[model samples]
Target: MLSTPNKQFSIEVTSDSTTVAPPLLSTTTKKLFIPPWKVPETKAPMVFPTCPPSCNKEMSRFNLDGSLKDLGSYGFWVEMCGKLFLFGRRFVNWEQNVEECCKIGMTPIDLELATDVKCINSLIGDDDYRNRFSRYYWTFGLRKTEEVVSSYYWCSSGANITRNWGSGGEPNYVKNASENCVRMEFGRATNMLYLLDSNCGLVSGLSCQGPIIPKTCDSPVCPVYTCRKRDALFKTLADKATKVLIDPSKSGIWVTNDTRLFMISYPSDTKTFVESLAACCAVGLKLLSLHQEVMYSILVGAFNNASIRGEKFWTAATDQGCKKNFGFCSTNRLVRDNARWASEQPDLSTSNGTCLAVSSDGLLHDELCNTKMRYVCEGRAQIPSLLDAVERECAAEFKLTRSEVKALFNSTPDELREKCFLKCYGEGTGLFIDGNLAMDSIFAAFQRITFDDTKRLLDMYSAMDYCTNSSKGMDECDKCGSLLNCGQENSPEEFEEFVETVQLTITESPLILPPVKGVCPEYECIKKPDQVKLLATAKNFTRFIGQAVVLPFVLQLTVVCNKKFYVFATNVERTLSRNLAFCCDRGYRMATIDTKEKYDCMVQNRITTFLNLPPGTTFAVGATRLGKLDRPSWCYSDTEFDFNLAEDFVSNDTLETNYGIAISFEPPLIMKAYETSLHVVCEK
Candidate 1:
């Protein structure tokens, strides 16, 4: 517990990016000091190249002095400073060579550094093996927009070329030649590895070096990160609660509190729609049919209090077929009574979005029921009485547990109990923490944390403690003014459990492995610009291994409309607004699909959207709608729906069905949406 002193105490701690801890122990002064630590650095791993076996035919068997060489190992590879460089003599156009290297899982020659120029020259200068080329070897990743000097840049990707890598007075664009591609001329030349631009279409040798990429999902190599914290929490709860007991009348359901019931799916398994429903029925719980707001709030509050807060779970609510009347499978209640729809969701626009699920935000969404998902079965005991229980409860009980009690009274309250539990864990773990924390003296000293992690450790400890002792009555503990002396007035023991130990809610952020992109060299690097930018940003994240980008990566894509305009989808959640006032400084306005042909072209690409959300989850489109909601007209070119298009991306008919316009990946007739991902056709 805590010691009473004449003066107040404070802990001063400083730490590095990874962790924080206090160092000094001076109780008399009442000022605890902490030391700083530097994050340790580890050496980067050395990568090697494994070229395709068929590349052997491209190598020369003889040397200049008539000495024969294997020339195997993919047409002569050289290792320089840990990077494996593989040289190929496959004659092809510059762009084609780049794609070929990409297919083979490598990057085109990027002679960015002076050392690269020197090393490449040393490898190709061996007269003993150097005579393997025509007049020159292609080494391009850039194009010459003009014949002038300093006009060259790495196209396909917006990377600038390092200064002075080209040969002196070279890239001359000799004799009006289309010297858009760079090449290296072999030996007898004073300036070795001197780069010069040549015709991009000319056949020349290819050089590539980089990492491999697993493009498809479900590949073992595909980046995938799962949040195992959720499953682990449920498993631990089930293991410890084995003796806490389950009601036989309710079957497998765990009576978490006096009113609510819960049945977490087995740790090892998940179920689809039919399986989940049948499983719930067998257990007599019925997949948690939250018939009213009061019931929904009660379940969320109890779940938040009994740990495992802020995770996704399946609910009993579903439209099943985009039917206007969606009801609880086990009840006579409809969802409209206690609606909990996520932004632009419960999208009855598509039949596939039938099953309902709840996320940490407490929003219910319509998803495909057959989609395998973890679920719960909930029920309530028959308080078969002459009256409702909340009205009969004492004021003290309401104050002590207002979060749960409020729900019983049909009052919606923000999450409070879960936040209080988090505070307790923080108090249990650290003496020096952020913010102004006014807590009891006994609780302050219990901050000797030795657990590896607070997630499972706090929950496990709480379940084992079975917290029962409380010196303070429920009447005074719930008042904000009593926080300073919130705990029971009693002598502190060897260790004191946190006030909210009986109920805990430790949350873990979900991990999503990003789409994989291959590593490329800096010089003359040509590839998809968007993909290049994505890789560049991903490289900084060591934990994700260049595989994950924090959410909203799709916002960078821009569509070139009929090769005429860059279409930019504004980040409005639903229906682009014609509010140019938001971007008046940049003269940005909403785009209009007034022309049927223009809209058709954008639609042809099947650019899916996030249901026209205002949030910039993807690259923005420069478009908007104008006029009143009922009599709305397009604002493109400031005209009243006057443009004619060849084909419509989303017809006026579909707009009425959706209540707004948004591009989707699914083709004409019906709409399909990939969960959490949407396309924004931005033309800029």
Candidate 2:
């Protein structure tokens, strides 16, 4: 096993990075080239991305409300303009596939409108989705009437886009062969044409198009709820930070609002974990030591509620630098516990597991101190570790030392071009991950890309697109899983001269990328948007990037897609005593969170907060405190909220900085407006 180091270090040598060879002789030439746009990239172009984890979870045939909830996560569920399309399972009969969709509440695709057909095909065509068996899927829209080719009509609508069919005569009927079914083939990265008629019993992929919103929140049903848009997701964090940073009128370094900073941790805004103990000692707050359930939940809720996805900052929980044998660095008194392990966690097999970082999943993972993960500093500023990481990728690929990379970054366009920037860009070609355009990361990759290589990359991608569409893999290129395995790395002998050339100039000044069409890639630096254009070349690059940058796409994809996971409503505001009466009188106890999943759900709805509500603000949850002096009993059940308490119901009465209130117990339902008049929401 490769063990990660606990100290910041520089790369002595690059990985088995591939060198670019002159293209294999082909009829294809430089006549074709597309511009590389600053957008999202993917291996296969599908309408909806490959279903995310939450969408792909193994669900039951029925939800709690007794509805079909088993939408195959393997397939794609797209809802567009009052139309629902399900590109369902492979190798299933047209009849069975349509029946499955109908059982879970959907009808087979009706390609009555040319646009509808285009949209469905766009999912396949744009995403370059192809059938594995090369077999087409069944569609109900096309049917044969007489033995004539012109006899076919759109089953759903009589008048339709007649010119929509592919070049190959569709609805082709052979001698006595039943052409009752319409099927279309989708190859990855290929522009699939119109549908064809085939035998009904023939096995093929399934795609069903119907209504936009399903009547039930069930399988074959993907509920897209009201969620933060791409731009709005990270806005809250920015607004709160701005308020604290700009307002000279306030001294709230750690503002405790409904959404901003919740707890005073070791240092989330600025410092790293190296001399972290001494740093925190200079101030007041120590590394976060979660001895109590309330502290843990508040922190977890704070982390989960943030719209930013996949991002994790360091907490002061570790066994390193402990005066006592096994405690946090800042507080030698705090002891370690095994209860928080997230199912086979704290991999004690490595010494580096001594450091810890908290994630939005409400659990802690062991990490090395020098993992290049971001951490909040004293009052502000993120630790400069991750920034240093971007610098490293630039240095290694460009064959430039640290100082040279810095000079290229700080230099003007003319200055960089003088340094042979275009050649450097060519050298860094084929560095992207499947040309995935999504570019949806908080950390910008230092994409040392140039004009010539960008065009080369695009050219190669277009050529591959041609090959896949033709179903004729390029010369010496097998139709592998997605794209070609035909790169310099795959066949190094062809690029031996290229490697020798790059290595020959190693000790002296290396060649930079040359200008193409009198322009360098990103010339004029129209925008120097941070460079996560390329991935980190470090070993910990994958692991470190794993913690914060990649999770947002997948982790938050399904997070916003559960509109059917109903959140009930109310504005009933009363004291704990009166709210309890209201709930009991209505045959419902206050809501209670019985599981970690429920806690996460509550956080998703923004129903749970760290804010201190006035006397009549918060709803009385199922959490019970028999006497004023008694420890609160958590884990109470509330049928209406469909929840049970998960922990202790202890909180500050006067709203101390350390002890703000959270329902602690999961209560189902309600949205509250931040008005002076209390708008209490209870389990409905």
Candidate 3:
């Protein structure tokens, strides 16, 4: 095997003369000498020949033995400046191609400019190859070495070309940096050359350096280009849509199962709720429901470019006409199917004024009764008969009258009284009675009596009377000094018994009366003595009339006597011959005896005695007595006490008798003493 650079040839020397070399002259001898043939280094840098004067006009000519060979049609050639030139077109490894071109005294093609691209296209003589050459191609200016060295060296002019490294580059070996072989589009650096292992033997196009000949060319319509630009547009749109659709964080576009027709941003006036819902419906999407997932989806885009009231978005759920059923409705299936039944039987009475909208926080919310919001209208579903029946049953069971309810609850035990009160009256019950006299009275009465008695009494009174009477009775009970009956009648004995009861009970009850005038007379006189009466009489007095002026006329009287004083009667048949004699002592004087009046007017003319009498005083015998007295009589008997005048006559004999018989007469000494006392008192 003969390893030749750029060519693989096998030689067999069978004769002795082929094996034996011919004599060769030394370089120092002057005689003519021929150099021995030897293989050149395969990994060496490529050497290019000097250009002739007609180099741009014609192909370079080269001889077979390291000399310029003449251009020929049968030999491999390349074009130059639109002229046909002989150049190899057979496949060869990149290293061999570079050596072969160097042996033929030409440089491998290195494409850099547009003209260079055209030149390579012409040289390839195949459309596909020319197209690829214009885009990317390798050259012998770079080579491979040990350690997979990838480096290249300029061949045509020995200039270091370091631009346009495609993908794989960088030398692995020192020699590979000078190696005359390279692969195109395989480098770490773009627009540059790199080294590779010589054993790789990958084929590539050659590169050449020269002033490029211009060519008339048509504008490209389908120039080869990467699809990255178109791909980038698709990728951007997809990324945006995904963010909007599945954002757990709300910074970006929000989405829902149903598309929100418009994004209402603050500062941008948009359509009303109804109008927005209509717009969404035009595109075949409904407003979101209470389903959190679906609601989240629908409200995704809603907050994108709009101002919202709160975070919540408005849904089709409503409680306006649903006061009777104000709670979450179990219509999950309907909601999933985009259908909703009207709550409370669809009374559209105020439908025109209601609206729905989304809040800033992306939750569904409602606006004011008359506000215009972006509403999500929904289609109605039929109410299930079973649910309706259940509701009716509940309504029926809950019906109750106020009294029945009160009785049912009030019957509870004392332990439950507080709870029952709260249930019946709501909150504390003390305020119900505060400052209300009638209520307080009723409560007070209840405390005083048993519940049964209170109920009976309350029933007996009319509503108006109950209130007025209760208030009045409360007032009386507060002040009255008698036992209160609370408007209930008691037996006479029981009434008496109650009176004997303590004053506190009397004050608390309502039956007692207020104070008034008048007394029970049957018991008044027995306890009082200043009101007794008396009478005045004279002897033989059938008719009597007298007038006396008395000062201090309001004197109270009291009389005590044992016997009745008498007034005598006159005899009509005969008049007594004797005249009634009247007598007066020295201080007692009888003024006149009047037969018509039948009494002597006796006046005590004693000054001290008369002056000593109190004003309005009168002296009389018993008209009514302290013990007991009968009609007036003259005979005072049966242990009677009396005052009467006595008369007597007396005689006395003188003691000196002898001288003359003299005689003397005297009244009785007691009577004489009376007469003498009366005369002596009168003289004083």
**When superposed on Cα atoms, how far off is each prediction in RMSD?**
27.5, 27.2, 65.8
User: Which numbered prediction scores highest in lDDT against the true structure?
Assistant: 1
lDDT by residue for model 1 over 605-682, one digit each (tens)? Answer: 533342343432332233222111233243223233421332233234323222223333333322211111223342
Q: Model 3 off-target regions past 4 Å?
A: 1-87, 93-99, 102-105, 111-138, 142-151, 168-180, 185-684
lDDT of 2 at 396: 44
Which 10-residue window of candidate 1 scores lowest in summed lDDT? 517-526
Model 2 scores a TM of 0.27
Off by over 4 Å in 2: 1-66, 125-135, 159-161, 168-180, 191-193, 212-684
Better of 1 and 2 by TM-score: 2
| Model 2: lDDT to the true structure | 0.35
* Backbone atom clashes (below 3 Å) for every candidate: 39, 52, 79
lDDT digits (tens) for residues 150-268 of candidate 3: 43454433445465443244444554433334444321112223333232243332333222223222111111212111122122111121111122122112222111233222232
Model 1: how far residue 190 lies from native, Å: 99
Clashes of 1: 39
- How far residue 413's Cα lies from its native spot in candidate 2, in Å, is 56
